[model samples]
Target: MRFAISIPQFYADGEFDPAAFRAYFARAEALGCYESAWAQEMTLSASPQLSPLEAMTYAAACTSTLRLGCVVFVTTLHSPVHLAKSLATLDQLSGGRLEVGVGTGGPQRPFAAFGVDRSRYLARFTEGLALTKALWTRDSVTFDGEFWQLKDARMEPKPAQKPYPRLWFGASGDGALRRAVRLGDGFFGAGSSSTAAFAAQVSVVREALAAAGRPAAEFPIAKRIYIGIDSDAARARQRVNAALAGIYGRRVPAIEEAAVAGTVADCVAAARAVAAAGAELILFTPLYEVPEHAGQIAAEIIPQLG
Candidate 1:
């Protein structure tokens, strides 16, 4: 199993220290402990978080070998053309070390706040995905869809990765999992999901791939896991629950239960369960004490995982 880490995004106003951030990536890359670094996007949330793309761009500049990505952009809320252009630029800027993750952002999201019609958001998401791929792969695109239209529109300096960077779909539902099999290069399970939930999603993904005649080896499956390592399991659990509550704007018992906490052994057991759930690439996200979490995971956790 491959291991990844989350790029910290929860910094308050004037709290971001560029030097510290650079050191984090540099150390991570130097140790070769992480294969990729990911960010999460949550716009209009009560918590303070950086924009995923911007955070990713900063990360790209800090580490040469570590692939940078956003776990899932709420694509339904974005303009397809603009999103495509931005990703293509980021791919070039990162020297092709870019992974794109997109999703519908769920039913609870305030779609109207983003000027999206709740009923048609799914159509917008599907069509937008198609448009983005066309822009990345073709010299010029011409298309007429229910939500958008383009005529001989050209996007220059196509993504640094030939045929575009890997597109990962963030999905939990069976229908969405099947769609990922047809449209995305990989399936990414949410950090908020439990190991059991992720396992069920993986089963659906595998079944969908088999039905589509797609090779399982070609489609990577991954999950982002919220983790905290502390000698006192109770303290770790308390801290994790508090941090997640702050980030999610409410306390969720399921998410708290899903998080990995406690001593190194405890974390290892949790991560092992996730691996058994079918995460080819597991993104270990430490919610609090980000720097210390990185060091501990690199020195203690990664060695045990293999």
Candidate 2:
């Protein structure tokens, strides 16, 4: 199974130091612990945040072999032509090591701010995805669609990767799952997802792939997982809970249950279970209190698995 690390660039307290983040990536690269690194996207949110694309672009410059990705980009917020060109530029700058993850977007306020009709978000998302993919593959294309229309439009500087970089879709509910299966090259789900829920989602993706006459192996499956590693399981739990509570403005009971905690062996076993459940890659999202826990995982859990 492939392993990756996700940095939470958002925080409720304290300023984010770019130098420290660069150091973190340096350490992670030196250890050879991760195949890729990813960042979360949140626009117009009530917290200190860094732009995911900008951070990933910086990371691409800092590391040589590690692939960089944004967990999910809100496609409904931007015009397809502008987004396609921007992503193509990012792919070229990153040396073809970019994976674009798209979502329909959530929350009414952000859509309102962007002047996107909340009721037509799904339709816009679908049309935008088609347009972006077309732009990546073809030279000049004309399309007439419900949300957008173009006449002989062309996008220059195609992605460095052949055909285009991989596209992953983030899904939560049944409708979202169907949409992802219909268009996405891969699937993404929340870190707090249960084993049964993950299994169901995987089954849906696999069946969809088969129905579409595509090989299952053609697409990679990635899931975000919250992790807190310490010698004491209780201490690990406490650290994760504190971070979640601080961010959400209330205690989150699900955080304690969803997080992978305890000793190195315990965390490894949990990772194995996730792999067995069909996740090819797990993006571990750790709380700020124990950011070094990733180092511990690299030193201990990875060795055991290897």
Candidate 3:
């Protein structure tokens, strides 16, 4: 299984320390424990955050080989053309070490703020995905769709990865899982989802791929795990809950249960269950005391995952 980590981005006010951020990447890259580093996009939220693209770009500049990505960029709320170009440029800047993730983010997003009609958002998401792919892979494109129209559009500097970067679709529902099988290069399970839920989703994706006669080997399955490591189980759980509340702006019980917080053995068992659930790639996202958790994971947790 492949392992990864989350990039630090939840900085508020004048709290961002550039030197510390650079040091984090340097240490993470030198460890060679993680195959890639990922960020999350929160365009509109109470959480003070940095944009995923900018964070990934900065992290890319700090490391020579570590891949950088956002797990899911609520593409439905963005301009496909602009998003595509930005990602393409980032891919070039990072020397092809870019992973592209997209998701509808469900109907709960503030669509009206982005001038989007909630009823037709699924259509918009599908069209936007198509348009983005066209922009990335084609020299010239003429397209007419329900939401977008373009004639002989040209996007310079195609992504460094041939065709495009690995297209990962973040999904939860069975229908969405099927859609990922139909359109995405891989499926990414959200960190908020419990291990049981991810197992069910993976079953749906696998069945859909089998029905479509697609090779499962070509489609990677990954999940982001919210982790808290400490010998004091109760304290670790409390810290994880508090950090999650800060990140999400409230206490979400389901997500709290989803987070793995306890002793090292407790974390190992939880992560093993995820791998058995079909997550070939597991991204460890330490909420608080990131560097300390990273050290624990590298020294005490990861070696035992096997």
Candidate 4:
């Protein structure tokens, strides 16, 4: 089973320790077991989080072999041209060690803040994705769409990887999962989703791929698992719930329930269940004590899971 870890992004005011951040990546890279590191995007949140792109850029500078990615950049809220250029530049900077995940977030996002039409967000997402792909693959692109229009535009040098980087889709519903099969390179189950739910989602994805005549091996499946490990069971659960609250900016019991918190054995069992659920790549996300979690995952947890 391939493993991935969350990049530390939580920082309040002057709390971002540059040396510690670099050291974290250094240690993670030395572990040599992780497939990649990913950051979450929360452009409008009470949480004091670093922007995913900036966090990823800093991480790329710190590590050599480790790949970098962001999960589910809400494409509807972005200007496709600018977003495409930035990602293409990052891919070049990172020597093509970049994975791009996109999603049309729920309808309740503050669309007005980003000048997105709430009623037409789905169209915006698909069109923007298509435009981004065109910009990445085409030397000169001419496109006429409802939201974006480009006439004979050139995105320089292209990405180091042919046909752009892998596009992973964060989706929940059946229609959206099918859409992911149609457009995205893979499916990424959310951290908020329970293992059973992820299993169900995996079934849907497999059916869609079968219907489309796509090989399951060509489409990778991954999930972010919120995990808290400690000898003190109650303390672990409490810390996990509090961290989830901070991440979501609200008390969400269901999301909190999705987290795995307890002893090392408990975590190993939980991770095994997730693997059984069909996650080829399991991204362990600890909302607190980033470095500690990475160490434990690499040393204590992953070894047992295997």
Where does candidate 1 clash, by residue pair?
Answer: none
Q: Pick the winner on lDDT between candidates 2 and 4.
A: 4
The alpha-carbon lDDT assigned to residue 129 of candidate 4 equals 95
Query: Which tens-of-lDDT digit does each residue in 98-201 have in candidate 1?
Result: 99999999888899888899989889999999999999998889999998999999999899999999999999889999999989999999999999999999
For residue 41, give model 4's deviation from the true position in Å.
0.5
**Tens digits of per-residue lDDT for model 4 on 64-175?**
9999999979888889899999999999999999999999997889999998889999999999999999999998999999988889999897877888999999999999
Better of 2 and 3 by lDDT: 3
In terms of lDDT, model 2 sits at 0.80
CA shift at 201, candidate 1, in angstroms? 0.9
Candidate 3's residue-wise lDDT over 135-213, tens digit each? 9999998999998899999999999999899999999999999999999999999999999999999999999999999
| RMSD value for candidate 4 | 0.7
Candidate 2 residue pairs in backbone clash: none
After superposition on all CA atoms, how large is the RMSD of candidate 2? 2.2
How much RMSD separates candidate 1 from the native structure?
Answer: 0.7
**In the order shown, what is each candidate's alpha-carbon RMSD?**
0.7, 2.2, 0.8, 0.7
Model 1 spans with C-alpha error above 4 angstroms: none
